[model samples]
Target: YLKKIGRRGKIDIWLVDGAKIRRDLEKDFTNFAEYYYFPIIPKYEFWIDRESVPNERRFFIDHLLAEWRLMDGGMSYQRAKEIANQKELSERKKAGDLEKVINQKSEFSPEKVHRRLLDKTKDEIDIWLVDGRLVRSAFDIGFTEGGHDLVYQYVPKNEVWIDDDVFAKERPYVLLHELYERSLMKSGLTYLRAHRKASRLEWRARHSEQILDEFFLKFLIKKGKI
Candidate 1:
């Protein structure tokens, strides 16, 4: 089986953003590392891989970046990271790794049920599990968003970035936090306040749901009917 799996089974550790991509594997791959992220053309800010950018649809990512004032260096730190990922993805497409591994359905696709929440958004949401180191570099967050939707509640576009280190039980909470917060933001709430409210509600539900699950499990153990 190992032979069949072959040497192509190398792990690709993804991160929340590009700038901190090296924070995790750099130490592990010190001697054997091959630096992939490089400065972009002209101004030469470093560019690196995203979790995975799907090419299933038309995109003017480059044009968007230019209009986004990304090249003028007027971009925010988060936007800078976003541009780097976009640049790296464009380069990857040129190298022919765009659709198969990066854009393949086997890698990412939207689902009706993520955990228990329904992503009723009009577009397909692409979800990615990124490296723990990458999550840490961004302040120990369990999840983040690359979503580019106009109305996050009513019609959010696809993108959900997750920390691979998040525990199985906690994963749903992380996803819930992101999704719920987006719904709030769509209602015109400020990010800071929306996040605060979302986290509180989600955290409460998290503990409450555990009790509900425990009751169900115990009842099932006693041969009680649902």
Candidate 2:
């Protein structure tokens, strides 16, 4: 059941279960995601565990908060634990006010970590190429031993590292889409929220770039350059 819930600022939000597709159609979650240009939320599956929590009951965040795990001000589970370990954080939870954990001043901020890793300006682009062993290090958590394709760390404030999975020109297109969507982020939306909203626009950006490429090719052909 595909549905458009609403808009989170300038971006549109859609809801669908990547795992639950028509069994008879021979479709896959990754294919469905690529077909829609949406991100796959591994946390939803809880690692193959059966879960169907209602909207109201699905409070907090955890497991792996990558593309889809991104909430406006959500913190990583490890960061949460670091907070939980803090003497002051424990007091807040005892007072039934643990939500403040996100407000504290400390390191382990996944976004901040990513930002530092990027260490680039809005106009600058950084691409890292590492082996499979460093995949988990890049994420600090996620990225199991199995391996993964191109990963958009988040906003351009973060670096996009490509593993040894045969890097090519396609990476630039993905990077462009990420940068474009991040550019669309307005004053109110958080980086995470902005990404979920930019899903649709990302595809459009990619297609437009392709159109320009075709135009350039035609021009070159007319000049007999190719």
Candidate 3:
């Protein structure tokens, strides 16, 4: 009964339910096609009851839009690099390292230190630590908050922040540093590499949400009411 229809990760299957045939047919012919396909027709009137749609459907659609906005031109690679460089310089100034800080202003202006960090990549552990530090710093800045009162409001241009209260209260930076360092020491680079790979996977997932939505729409259409 469970015949394999495709390769793994892209498999499809058909199910039959004699007892619930009426319910299944109603869904296939009316509910699914009405909500998904009727909207496609130029002059077709489609009425969807808000309470009828599944929660997962709404979640998927909303998440797709959110990811699309995040990866839009507003947060381009050049913008990210510029923000990172400015924040690094500001931190140096705050730490009274102004005298030692470099004056050049190109992509590789702080060449020595940047090169040092890049060279310290003895293993994946080092890269994970760097990524953890970046995440911890963002958390300290109130970027994790749910409202408009977050650090993002005041520091609108940059996507990172340094909230004094949050930093003092939770000390997430120290915790993350300790946790990652301990994980690195105990498990070697395996866990660290997994973390890095997971981060990349997350980015890809966010970027591909729109494609997934289109796929779902196509599925609904192929089932009939297009």
Candidate 4:
């Protein structure tokens, strides 16, 4: 079926269950411009491969730091530490051997790492220092966890610099939001708070429906009726 349609223009083929095909068809189809196969399913289903995951984290942290750096004109110690810890944990997980240590609770938990970040940045003042002189201080620097408890810090630095620490504590949602905001900012589009809230609510609604459906299926199985 795939080969019959490949004669026309350039075709990029993705073979999901190509192993089921006869060897003759496989040989004939190998002449395509490009072909890829999904041989082994990844252990971590929701995330990308270990090698690529750090890049994804770096992309998000860079965006966030760029924005915050512009606003405050420098980076905070807490944010820096948070980003570093996230990258470290990712590397440890990628090594595979650390999985046993992680399971045994010998490694740092994500929450504890984030808390440690808060502790480290608590006293630093966001100041732009140039040639041993304090230049500009951030007017407003705010850090919050989960909800609305605002913690403000003042830190002074020469220029906006992103260390390894700030890259590690970035959450997936934070990265996605930063990317979306950057795209919107580039396009000169303004995002409304109400619209953002509605979008999140809609996602939760669909997720709840899926969870309910799964639970109902489990109930039927428990009752021996499915």
Task: Compare the candidates by TM-score and give the number of the best one.
Answer: 1
In the range 1-226, model 3's lDDT, one tens digit per residue, is 1222222122222222211221222222211111222333122222221211122222222222232233343565445434543454345345444333234552211212211121111122221112212221222221221111111233222112222112122222222222333334345555456445433432333345554344324323211111
Task: Kindly indicate the candidate among 2 and 4 with the higher TM-score.
Answer: 2
Better of 1 and 2 by lDDT: 1
Q: What value of lDDT does candidate 4 attain over all alpha carbons?
A: 0.26
10 residues in a row with least lDDT, candidate 2 = 55-64
Per-model RMSD to reference: 13.3, 15.1, 22.1, 23.5
- The TM-scores, one per candidate, come to 0.33, 0.31, 0.20, 0.19
Instruction: Sort all candidates by TM-score, best to worst.
Output: 1, 2, 3, 4
Error of 1 at 103 (Å): 15
> Which stretches of model 4 miss by more than 4 angstroms?
1-139, 143-170, 193-226
Model 4, C-alpha of 4: deviation from truth (Å): 67
lDDT of 3: 0.27
* Candidate 2 lDDT over residue span 162-216, tens digit each: 3322223333333333444444452455666765555444344344666435533
Please write out the lDDT profile of model 1 over residues 145-188, one tens digit for every residue: 32223333212255554444344444445555565666677779
Q: Local distance difference test, per candidate?
A: 0.37, 0.32, 0.27, 0.26
Q: What number of clashing residue pairs does each candidate have, in the order they appear?
A: 1, 0, 0, 20
